[model samples]
Target: MKGIKIGEYLVNSCTMYIEPVEYANKIYSHIVEVEEEFLSPFKPLQNIKNSCDYFGVDYESRRKGT
Candidate 1:
């Protein structure tokens, strides 16, 4: 699959599977906000084990597009 390599992370340009929720509307709302603000809308590849595996840096503290 074609994707962008941001540091060591391979972010696939595809939509990921999100499980449907029944209750916990408040929690769902927070999740939506976090996805919009922090998580990028890219599917994580299965091959990638850790962020350092691709980016050549420590996995503890690393930013995307760095």
Candidate 2:
């Protein structure tokens, strides 16, 4: 994001997702890191079911941003 580097890596500018309210009294969105290799819009979502299960997120729920 905006070439924000983590260590020696210059992260490429790319789309990012903001997950909200992961903590108490926090109304702001938090940056959720995406794998650099999967940043391309052309790439399919990796490990769909496992990710959803792990994250406790559903496809349509995520789609609606609810």
- Relative to the true structure, candidate 2 reaches a TM of 0.27
Listed in order, each prediction's TM-score against the native is 0.21, 0.27
Compared with the true structure, what per-residue lDDT tens digits does model 2 show for residues 1-66?
232322111122442553333234333333335643222211123333334556677766765774
State the lDDT of candidate 1 residue by residue for 36-57, as single tens digits: 3222233333223243566576
Q: Where does candidate 1 clash, by residue pair?
A: 8-54, 8-55
Candidate 2 segments whose C-alpha is farther than 4 A from its true place: 1-49
Candidate 2, run of 10 with poorest lDDT: 3-12
Cα lDDT of all candidates, in order? Answer: 0.30, 0.36
Error of 1 at 20 (Å): 11
> Which whole-number lDDT from 0 to 100 does residue 14 have in model 2?
48
RMSD of 1: 11.5
- Highest-scoring model, lDDT: 2
Regions of candidate 1 where Cα sits further than 4 Å from its true position: 1-9, 12-49, 63-66
